[model samples]
Target: MVRISEFQIKDVVNVADGKKLGNISDIDINLQTGKIEAIIISGTGKILSLFGKEEETVIPWKNILKIGEDVILVRFNEKNEFHIQEEE
Candidate 1:
């Protein structure tokens, strides 16, 4: 059983480019289904990062391939066109 605190400490990496995408800041869960729909990563590579990113990267759960002790491997688009679920 993985606790949310434990999940937060791991680095999120893109398997395609092996870029460290930062850590998990939050998770989007489908309350109706009681399942995680996506993981939100801290947006850090922006030029105006000190002012905070315009939007955080929300990676769909499907993109995640592996969860190791210290890192999470995900396969996402290089374009950064992450899929965000429509709000109700």
Candidate 2:
């Protein structure tokens, strides 16, 4: 078993394209079922970051392929576009 805090420290990577998504900034959970729904990745600042226009990426739990000691590997189709939304 791993604590949620542990997830914050591990980097999240996409195995399909070998892209490093970033670390987990938050998570979505099903309170009623006590299950993890998805992992939320905080966006990296861009040139326009000064305007606070970054979007957070959400990775569904099913997309996660493996959780390792230092990284969490995920798999997504080539056409799979990450869900992005304004930070809360």
Candidate 3:
């Protein structure tokens, strides 16, 4: 029984590339099923960002490998990912 607040503090690390995808900003859930559909990781301002906008990576629930105390391990592929960029 994990709380959603706990998830926001953990860092999301990709096992494939060992990239820190940032912390979780939001979650997508299936209202009908009462299950998580995806995890949204909002990127902090990087030194070099695309169009000066930060990116939000949406990782499917299936991609989540393990949920640890301090970090969440995920199997992420850069080429095949759903990203939602924040428009300023």
Per-residue lDDT of model 3, residues 1-88, tens digit only? 9999999999999999898989999999999999999999987774364567777899999999999999999999978987887865
lDDT for model 2, on a 0 to 1 scale?
A: 0.84
Query: Model 1, range 1-88, lDDT digits (tens) per residue?
Result: 9999998999999989999988998999998999999999865554444554344688889999999999999997947656333222
- Separately for all candidates shown, the number of backbone clashes (residues 3 or more apart, or on different chains) is 0, 0, 0
Compute each candidate's TM-score over C-alphas: 0.80, 0.84, 0.86
Ranking by lDDT: 3, 2, 1
Worst 10 residues of 2 by lDDT: 45-54
Q: Assess each prediction's global lDDT (C-alpha) against the native.
A: 0.82, 0.84, 0.91
Model 3, residue 87: C-alpha shift (Å): 2.0
Tens digits of lDDT, candidate 2, 32-81:
99899998888786434555666678888999989999999988553665
Best by lDDT: 3
Candidate 2, residue 51: CA error in Å? 2.3
Q: Where in model 2 is the C-alpha error above 4 Å?
A: 46-49
* Inter-residue clash pairs, candidate 2: none
Off by over 4 Å in 3: 46-52
What TM-score, to 2 decimals, does candidate 2 have?
A: 0.84
